[model samples]
Target: MSNFAILITRRQFAITATATSRTVAQRVYVGKPDKISNIRPLAILKNKNDSPLETQLKELQMDTQQWHHKFWMNHNKMFSKSREEFDEKWFAKKQVSSSNQSETTKMLEPEDMAIFHRNFLHNNLEAQRTYDREWKTRNKKLLFLSAQVAFQRFYFKWFKSFFSRKS
Candidate 1:
């Protein structure tokens, strides 16, 4: 046998090890659906039915568009930081083995095991904190989206009322 496999670094080996264990996987999209139709369509203009409410509604829609743009921009910025934090906390630092231990002998002392467990617990705690932070951000975004949908439905109902009364 060649020594080619033995030449890989620990990081490379860890990556290959994890990659082989997965049976099925696919890329997932994390972006929120930003289509206007997905939210709700703004009031369509009626012929010769210009009203103050319609004007105000149009202005509010414009303001909402700006708010959405800002929200997404800020979310993208925060997302990067959150992802980095998650990665940092999720993976534990590689522990260097003493020179005396060989790859064949998988032996650990009680003190070493205790240290290992402590590190594991610390990493787990950090991972939980990271998860909570991400969950909060996701929920906040969901709430904002629900509010938008509610606003759109309300405005559309008002628009229909105005058009029906005008006819």
Candidate 2:
């Protein structure tokens, strides 16, 4: 084929592939009484401010890293549960509930569930990474605050020097 003909063929394939894929508008789906292939729609959070949960958490100083660690470590009893409950309830059970089901049956081979596991593991790792980064950031701020609170080396010197400099 000529170079132009090859270009045209490639363009045709690009157009076809793009056309076949779902777009954002299609995200608002008319789901069948059937299995889902993609993400479930999220409920809109109409009111962003003043959730009861946030208020309760704040009263417990949950924003502080130590408090958060203590709260989670204590409250997440499954953290030290038998391995089966830990795996079955927290990890594998998520896939079962998240999967779409019909009136009578659910899809067995809708997609290989390993992809879901792969995605979940990837997400879990990313979340842990972000959590570590935030903890480091918070620790830096706390360290700076402690230094400001306890260190007065420059304060007395600056105050005494300011008057002398004017003279």
Point to the candidate with the largest lDDT. 1
User: Once superposed on the true structure, which residue ranges of model 2 sit more than 4 Å away at CA?
Assistant: 1-67, 74-78, 86-123, 153-167
Instruction: Tally clashing residue pairs in candidate 2.
Output: 0
lDDT to native, each model = 0.44, 0.39
lDDT of 2 by residue, 1-167 (tens): 11111112343232111111211110111112212222222212222342444333333332453444543454333333432343444434446543432321333333534554565556467655866787777667666654553344345446777999999
Where does candidate 2 have its weakest 10-residue lDDT segment? 17-26
| Reference-based TM-score of each model | 0.29, 0.29
What is the C-alpha lDDT profile of model 1 across 36-85, one tens digit per residue? Answer: 32222222232233344444544554455455455555555554565444
Error at 167, model 2, angstroms: 18
Pairs in clash, predicted candidate 2? none
- What lDDT does candidate 2 reach at residue 108? 36
How far in Å is the alpha carbon of 135 misplaced in model 1?
A: 0.6
